[model samples]
Target: MKPTLNEQLRQNIRFTYNEALELIVAMGMAACGEQMYAMAQDYKIEMDPMADSFYEDTKARLSPHTFRELQFFFGHNFLHKTLDFGFYVSICSNPEPQSADDWIRSLEAVPAEWMLTEMVFGVYHDKLEELLQGRDWEASKGNLSLLAALVRDTPPHQEVIHTQEPLLECLAHPEECKLRYMQLLSQFYKDVFIRWKEPLKERSEQASAHYETLFAAKPEQFIREIHKNEPEIFISFPAAFHVSQASQVGNHFLNFTTAAGNVGWVIFGIHNERVFGPAADREQTELFLKAFSDKRRLDFVLLLKERPHYGQEIASALGITPAAVNYHSNFLFFLDLISVKREDHRMYYHLNVERLRELLALTAKVMLD
Candidate 1:
């Protein structure tokens, strides 16, 4: 079928998050998932008491199965992108499947990969070398048995596959274990989801209702007004992501969609709000003043007032890196002091004169009152 994402400009947009899957995935990735770690590398969460407590408690509750083999198996691994992994898209629907059966069926249907890609890194990297050394068929029984269970029909002798990061001794029988491993993960996900189902369901319902209402009324404008810099239609519906900057976004993803006909993405974000507070209280005049007290941000804002400029252009003019420009602009963007425009791949940042005026008025009102 055609993507049809651009056709219904309004109904396709949606917001979604799988609390259970996300939590498990977070823990799994924390062990060795590169992408997950990168997103969480920033922010000194250890300094935040609540964040610290949550982290420790969650860690303590983890079982060996949940923390090790299972984590590695279910989490992203050597064959992450290569296989039709069921868990990644398991909860991508409305009124998420209410029974474990849905997951079972999904796992059973996972497409197989012909080869078990080599694992480059992990706790077990090269651990197989010792087992494979000077071993006859009978002596390799332990290794063969495990491989036999994972892969169908084993030969008299098998060779291990090498990988970039030592993640795997060989890509043998990886896809064979898809169903059994999935069954295990399925139970874990269901139990945890049920235990917290009440709160998770309630949050989901309220959020769904809120989005339905918002999208029902001028859905196109909602996308354009809030995310002018994004595409009219996302290639993937209901996308998700995580962030270490809890103070910046709280416990919510920056969610929005175009064409309400169907959801294009659900950005499941790890807001990490369990750890901290907001950037600043708008009611606090000193906070507002302090926010703009940064000379670099102030200069960036002034430049936007003249004309729209992208991060790179702004960075070039300031004799700094583009990343520096993004860092400074993010502050102004969060406070609504600026607006963004997208033309193809390039993002143009513009100063919001009206927003500045409102803040100025609010500042005056606060001072006089």
Candidate 2:
């Protein structure tokens, strides 16, 4: 039997640790393409068009300069989004490009479309700028505000605006600004769909297939069996479950719990799961309850420390049912381990790290001894 995704991921974790895993989770397919590109670039490998259709397709829509900028932006976003996982882990674990020249050479080696989005915004950008040049600065700003708002609420407006300030400055008429913004936004959607629709569909299908196989396996049973046979493989936690490689069943190779008590399986060779010490025995369970009143509450604190996640994000990370995340997060707030900030209607939970560490240390000292 092939090692499941979880098994592959567990091995990856052991070798590469958590940063690589987080990169995979947060960046998904994009990060994979980047690593491949970096490796090829460093080794002076030629880029293969067939394998890199995504990057190529995205490049076709832009000028050479803009395309280079886009790559930089994408790469920067990739690193920024993954910063919490730590820098050293990212550098040492993956195959990365050694220099700028290497990156350019690597780009030559990979299939373009595989690494880049299909949508080309260059043509539309020129047209949109031409339209905006006749307008006043205030009108342009208003136009941009309207477009930004529409992008979030309306699915049709998906233009990758390179510089919002420039676009805003070019608009002439206050009333006409809305109309032009709508036109630009609509064109963006149309262009994206036309250029990359098939690839996007394929990507979606691949993701669905990957997850379907991942969620289908019996995660708990796999974890328990691994714990029984390869005891050393499992990482123990005082109040949480162990982390270990599951049987090479299906597409999952490793399993671990979220700070919120949800069990998740990662794809093969993506090691992102944090190992807590061990599952709580009855006595330990009782002690865990006494220390924190609820394990979920403690899990909430962990989630905040792990990332700057909102409720939905926390819920997804923890693999807990949505209702449970909200419920436990409320409890955590009440306990003063976390604070909820309201932006619009969405609430973001930030961890009180000092408080959390103090509590975690106190609890660990009591439980371990």
Candidate 3:
């Protein structure tokens, strides 16, 4: 018999203080952390000043060419498909220590086809096999039109188009891309992350121990708390859950990927949000109201009421840019009134209608009584 989600989680989930893997993610973020903060500021969200200083120092450590290469490879938002490669490396190097040299060697051993597929389409899926059955990676390397065709089939397509240039560049010169990646990792790790290695390792261990205690006591609740934005996955376990070092100060970075097997893998973030599943309190109610009070955000929810929309579509409808939509969406996400879905290798924003109705009833009761 197949195991239940809880059993699978208990059996498959592995948490550790992998310095090498964390460095991969940290370097990727360092590549684009300043840009991320600027985008946040555009939406009126203030980030930690120390994170700003950290990113500035990281930028100073890189040569001009290397810095551009890092941004080109990772993208400005650090959401490039290739970033998933770090997690893939961790998955392979588990139960054994991983080193920086091991990371580059792993990249050398990976097939060009595997790297290209992951880059073109954010994550690999069997359906992609059917889509590109006859076309080989070498042939598709410089084919911009092929990317358009694939993106068209995927819902919420515009965002994927934003990544086409970097994806194509990586495909065209896979070896150069690997070399640049290796250089960025080696240089950044040596200059910036080496001192950080031990401190981050200690934090990861402490966080892992804390989460393990909560998870062993109440598995579902623990998952819900960590995934405050999308609470349903606890009911159906994903590929695996990983705990890693914090990339930015004060804000935990969470990334979800579907690796080679079509199973979901999530790099769980630090637990920082207030628990949302328990009975709603006065503070929670006020938080919900503050979220809805924004006219644009209210409009966003109303648009979702008509049907789920992706970031690009929502931005277009609201006369705002995609970055603005992202900021407003973050608030809606934390409130649990919306959840994210991945379909056809792209992301779509979904409304939790039941959660919305629950809030309405609660608000009405409070006002009338």
Candidate 4:
């Protein structure tokens, strides 16, 4: 018999531990690389094969340094990509499935580009719902403002507004107006914008200080620097770099020499987070760093980790009210950290244990030291 979805996912995780890590890292860095590429594309910035060439040349010249930067870049990028994809998968795969084929088909059908777009829309929808429910939009106005700025920066936003002006004008009431505008606006920018843009923007703002510390002239320089400074660090390469040479070829060399083990690759590019299993292995390295952070809400994760328990069981275990647990659990489930199994009258929770273990190990190594 074929493996169950959970079982299959576990096997995949175990089988490709290094690859999975690589994918997570790749996903994270790609989030930045892709975002930069999109922005460059929008500005018609002459597509330099140099970035790819530089990356390769640097890797070859300074493999160590390039590796470390790649790893840092990947870690930073993975978390955002994972959470974004996780949320998208959760919403798209509603009303949990009973058969493996149904679930597999569901996974296969997820359009990565659309998934990212919908996730942005979902965030806007939730914010609008919150505003409608008496929450203050002004309190979170900074975020709203940023969203607006992101829309303005991307060319697609202008196109979306031009095309969707009618829809925006139709929902002109105060309660719905902002959201409608954001919804329409996000649609246009989604293709060009990545979830990691916010973090990258923050990083870019502090570029002069952080760049020398984080990025390398070559891959070997990255590895050697990490060996001298942060000996425990693990780094991975982006698939794009494997194909480019914008950096000095030697600078891009990777040093996987740490006694604690080195970074891994996720391989695939942007993908749907909900599509769990070996197939989802490509470019998922971004998840390792993002999921490791405390921002992921531990209680929900604990509930999922414990067992395939029902709502009340999860609530009781976490020492919270059922309604609260339901809200949080739903969010975690939405994030793809947990899965729901409905049996007749109730739903049970199952955590993605293998992924959890991988994340935990990486986090312990990176942060604990």
Q: Among these predicted structures, which one has the highest TM-score? A: 3
lDDT of 4: 0.36
TM value for model 4: 0.25
Q: What is the C-alpha lDDT of each candidate?
A: 0.45, 0.37, 0.60, 0.36
Would you estimate the TM-scores of all the predictions?
0.43, 0.24, 0.60, 0.25
Candidate 2 residue-wise lDDT, 1-369, digit = tens: 887645543443221112223222322223235665664453334344433564445445544544343333233322222111222222222332122223223334333221111111211323444434454433543243444332233222134343233223322232343333233323323433245434443443443343334323533334443222232233331111211111011122233344444232323311111111133233333443554677666666666787667778878777788798877765555435678788768888888878766556646655684
Q: How far is candidate 4 from the true structure (C-alpha RMSD, Å)?
A: 22.2
Candidate 1 TM-score, true structure as reference:
0.43
List ranges where model 2 is wrong by over 4 Å: 1-35, 39-51, 77-194, 220-369
Q: On residues 169-189, what C-alpha lDDT tens digit does candidate 3 reach at each position?
A: 665666776666667767777
Model 4: which ten-residue window has the lowest total lDDT? 241-250
Candidate 1 Cα lDDT to native: 0.45
Off by over 4 Å in 3: 1-8, 38-53, 79-97, 111-113, 123-156, 228-240, 247-265, 271-283, 289-355, 358-369
Candidate 4 Cα errors over 4 Å, as ranges:
1-306
- Per-residue CA lDDT of model 1 for 64-168, tens digit only, reads 665554444534441231121234333333234224345455546544331122121122223434433443433433353343333332211122222222223
1 against 4, candidate with superior lDDT: 1
For candidate 1, which ten residues in a row score worst on lDDT? 114-123
